[model samples]
Target: MNAMVQSTVPASRTRLPRKERELQILDIAHARFAEHGFGAVTMDEVAAAAGVTKPLLYAYFGNKERLYSACMERAGDAMLAAVGAAVAAATGPSEALRDGLKAFFAFVDGDRDAWRVLFDETLPAGGELARAVAEYRDRLLALVAQTQLELIPEHSRERAATEVEALSNALLGASEALARWWLRTGALPAAEAADLLVATVEPGLQARAALRDRTASPSTPDRDQGAP
Candidate 1:
């Protein structure tokens, strides 16, 4: 059967889905926020960069704070999903950590601007935008804590849940500092950054995981138990 072939539309003129267009605008906004601080960036700037009218931009996000919040929310969602997918796809705990770190570094390297938006203090200290970024950070810490709970044996997890959560937060904080340094230095490859985290954490993680397994194992009964 013969079918009619549709002519290709120009990408520039193509009408993207609402969410897709929103993402396109956010990408430009991320770059703008990175170059100029969030406070300095304006809807006009984002609109011009995104090649959309100011009215269209406003229609999508309402106002500057909302627009910035949307960008941060999107960035966080993408980053968390990337690392979570990496961890879920791994065959084992250690491999999960490695893959997750690799995915994180990849995300950071791929979108340094987005990273800046998420972590940049130059944004308003108290506002909806700041709150959005903070919530993302809290979720990142929660992701670490939840992952630990999922992979550990129940017996060990019960005893160590609080300690593990605290450690997870500390580790995340250190990782964030190192990431900032990595960005500033600009010398380390993404793989090396990931390797640093895996090397630093894997041995301790494995040791604890081994302990969990041992603790959860059933003990053998004594041969003379009945004679006592």
Candidate 2:
């Protein structure tokens, strides 16, 4: 049986909880920072956008630098989650690689300004923010190298190892550059840009696969004498 209870309740409005408010502040702050660049955004601007007082903004984020850092962290996490989810769902290396690139481009499409802050070296200078972005990039490169290694052919282990690292870095740089170009020219759909990237990458990946196969050792058949 389903029971319904009724109570005399007031309809007073409630403010967003502190935790939610902080997230709201961060979202607005991230957009502002991305739109105006780090230096051009201010606490008051963020506060106004957030519909909060400057003091409230300060209470949550402390300062512009900290706010910038928070935005970077959020953007990086979002980007990684998208790529990681795509990679996890893929059944094969080529598909995984393609999906990862698509996820990355989708992220850039959704959060262009945030991606700019995280990828562009020209943003807020020096200190922890720069260090965080550098660390994130390094980690992303490592993941790319790992993914490439998985796609490497067994016969060409040595060459594949050397080439995958280079290819990974090249793809990373090219994706970032292409995203920036897309932002500037608005010439291609994000999917088209990702497809173009995949086209550039596939030949090298095919070479790696071919090398592995060519170098792989053949399995031996059982002798007629016994199955030992």
Best by lDDT: 1
Model 1 bad stretches (over 4 Å): 1-24, 48-56, 208-228
Model 1, 94: alpha-carbon shift in Å? 0.9
Tens digits of per-residue lDDT for model 1, 1-228: 123333353356568899899989988887788878777988888898888899999999999889878778877898999888998898876677778778888999998887887887787778787778778888888767766665677767888888788878877887788889899998799889889977988778768777878756667345568623
* TM-score of candidate 1 on Cα atoms, chains taken together: 0.77
Off by over 4 Å in 2: 1-15, 154-163, 212-228
Q: Weakest 10 consecutive residues, lDDT, candidate 2?
A: 1-10
Clash tally, candidates in order: 0, 5
lDDT tens digits by residue: candidate 2, 1-228: 123323445445349999999898888888777777887888888888888888888888888889888988988888888888888898887888888888888988987876877876567567877788888888778767766776876555576677777888898898889988988898999999999999888787877587567646455345665746
* TM-score, per-candidate, Cα-based: 0.77, 0.78
